[model samples]
Target: MESERYIRQTILKDFGLKSQKKLTKARVLVIGVGGLGIPVLQYLNAMGVGTIGLIDNDVVSLNNLHRQVLFSEKDINKTKISVAIKKLKKQNSTSKLIGYKLYLSKKNALSIIEKYDLIVDASDNFPTRYLVNDACVILGKPFVYGALHSFEGYVSVFNHKDGPTYRCLFPNPPKSEEIPNCNEQGVLGVIPGIIGNIQALEVVKVIAGIGSPLSGELLIFNGLEQEYHKFKINSLSKNKKIEELKDTYELECSFDNSSISSDAFKELLNSSTEIQLVDVRTTEEYNDYHLKQATHLPLKSIYLNHNSLDFEKTIYFICQSGVRSLEALRFLKKEQPEATLISINGGLNEFRNYDAKH
Candidate 1:
């Protein structure tokens, strides 16, 4: 009875009983249960991929219902693992599903990842994507990568058979503000279905050993334009070492620099101070709440107009929090290594609070 469920997929000459058998025995891990992850989980379970491991630490939210199909309005504030697991179980009782209700971090990444034969990196952030890629590289397991932004999404297979890795494709994380979060830039629900299904297809092809698995190529889809493109990724030739996982948010990941305290930042903000202030926050953010003395150069346009700043002078940087400011500092340092660029310790939020105290 269990074998009959997968007969339709097994009916293909190339993907016969043998491939079905392989899928039944394969252990796979999917790292997210969000928009991209929902479709991957659905189709993979439908395909009867045995021993599916789901690792996500988020609870269902009102915002998630817009694109994440696994949870409903009633499930809001409930754990995604609980909601998704129950739904998947009802959909395919034959496939084993284990859900971890915790997020992936450097501490648990390697241990949790090593247990799986393959990984699907449907993770939302650049840090986790790098974390998963490094873990898979170390574990010698191929993982499918999926990312969504606005009406665009892309899928690729990384760390397959010592092939090009995520770093091979994107050697550096984009400047934090340059890549907007889903909350900032909206994505159509159908986009993830397209990319996640392709990710699922790659998983099937790799496990079944049936067709080309997109090992060294990237697939990009634009929902607005209804266009698709595939490009070759040749990171294998570069042979950049992925011997071990470095700090995902460190200089190795392409953004690392220094920070200054709020007290010092306020002194610099004082009229007597002679430091140039650079605000990496958006024009809207600047309009809302900003230091009058600070110059507006959002992180997205920093690379283009960074040279306009007088590198010889001491420049202080600030953002909503210190994170983006540090990222901007790193970018500035890379282009102008000699520039004395330091981010405000607590960003504008802290700097503003300092004013209330005074």
Candidate 2:
């Protein structure tokens, strides 16, 4: 270890050389390389965390540049984990960086997560968050959780030393339509950075055995109002009983059954003028690029304007990725249960790929 490099932090009275040594012995795994993950990784690695592992199957896209600051225009389309690992290595050569360029699913979550001393839930979606929580509970590991909404962010440390798990706060996952993700309801660029840094702080505190970790209290930050709020979360005995991974953690939504491949959606688009295709991405995203035949109806405004959609025809929903479209389908399914609604699986990215090929 380079003592001089971390001398400033090591010099603190409460966090002396002993705490620095603890940081060096820590092994942390971050679940995403997106907005929140970037800051968490940067701080932990710089602070002398001995080993860090990151898993992400996503690629850097033009849209990701706004929040995922570690990536640049030149890195677009490159695998996130590979790009992150390469850049992080240059930042701290002494810290070991491990990259798993794969989505965290039941098949791989247990095996990979077991190797790390701490897990950071930096993922955007609910499915991955739940998967990480259950896996950590099963393995008796602690995980720092962070999530983003419009201009708001939340941070909490779960399953730490018999503390409250995520399920204690949220006993069950909300219906897809009840809560849209940051993708559906756009997030301010700085939100993740603020929340991620807090997560990093909690990680250091947990590893070094100093300061109170956010184990039972959920920290909520509102960037717009510049406000911070904390709510206590009590542990649920049932949540800690998770012995094994669920058969499947996929969220229940109509989109699962009513999804069509991009190729099939394209064929349907070409075949029928009667098909009502709606783009559920933000107006900016729709303005940037959208199918000429698709109507722009941002997911954030879908509930208010859903009645405008024609129930007589089979409506197809599309977004940058399949997530928002699935959320849209779920919303419409409740509003117009009799109407036929379909989601374009893989969304515009897959559509653009097939379009480029053809």
Candidate 3:
């Protein structure tokens, strides 16, 4: 038998053959292969969890190498799930690794997650978090939740034996503008590793039933201070039950016209050309390289300066990859629906790519 591979852990009084058998039969689905997901994948695989499913559609970038330990410069531009699989496979072949190039969507989430016994919320966005929580609640499956921003990271177990759900912590999704995500705020490379390891540890504990899980508690780690704090999340039964999955996720529900391709946006730029461009990226990003005549209005200050936006020209909002731009678009559309609106597809990434080719 492969018991030799787990001999060290099996020798522990609490985590012996019974726990190892539970781990060998357990099925875990990790939601993202980004910063948090990669580390989570490595540990889960090393622990010999049976049937680990990796779902991610994003590509590996040069910038991701610092924190996404499974990826390297050679893996740049490759699909993150694919790159992560190669590394996880090499780590341990005993664990059955399944790779899905698809992203988590409301339509398929229930079906995709139904097969797994546990869910790992390694996602970077809020809508996906809600989706996972709802799915877990609906299926009576527990989930390990991890999140990071700057030097801060959070880990929590939601819907574990009816303990507490994510909504118990935050009743509703914050207004898109109020939450500027890790992309806009930026994160130190090592923050996710710390939180992800916690998530991985929680997964092992929950699956093997070995220790006291953070069922109703949230663990916050400050890398700068190297301090850890645990806080209780009260059960909010008002919104706990989910009868049916919503057709739309709130992240994209507000902004239908989020972004367009660089080529199409370029055509809009040169022809008919009454575009009023606003870069929603930070000032530092704008100073680095930006469209020659575009105004540098960061997402944080957009609300304060929105009144000054030109109503006459067709507005084209730009950001790193149009995420912030779409957030801004939602705000602007609600504020100034009378104005013509458009978003640079792919944002500055497209702009740089076009410039490089031309």
Superior candidate under TM-score, 1 versus 2: 1
The best candidate by lDDT is 2
Backbone clashes, candidate 2: 0
* Model 1 Cα lDDT, one tens digit per residue, 275-322: 688889888888787776778899999977777788898787889888
How does candidate 1 fare on TM-score? 0.73
Ranking by lDDT: 2, 3, 1
**Better TM-score candidate (1, 3):** 1
**What lDDT is reached at residue 318 by model 3?**
87
Please, what are the lDDT tens digits per residue for candidate 2 over residues 1-358?
4999999999999999999999888899999999999999999998999999998999999998898889999999999988899899999999999999998987799999999999999998877888999999999999999999888999999999978999999876665667888888997788899999999999999999998999999999999999999999999899999998753455232235467767656766665677788999898888777888888899999978877899887888988889999899998899889988888888899876443211
Q: Give each model a TM-score.
A: 0.73, 0.72, 0.71
TM-score of 3: 0.71
Segments of candidate 3 deviating more than 4 angstroms: 251-358
| Poorly placed runs, candidate 2 (over 4 Å) | 253-358
After aligning candidate 2 to the native by TM-score, how far in Å is the CA of 141 from where it should be? 0.3
> Clashes in each model (backbone N, CA, C under 3 Å)?
0, 0, 1
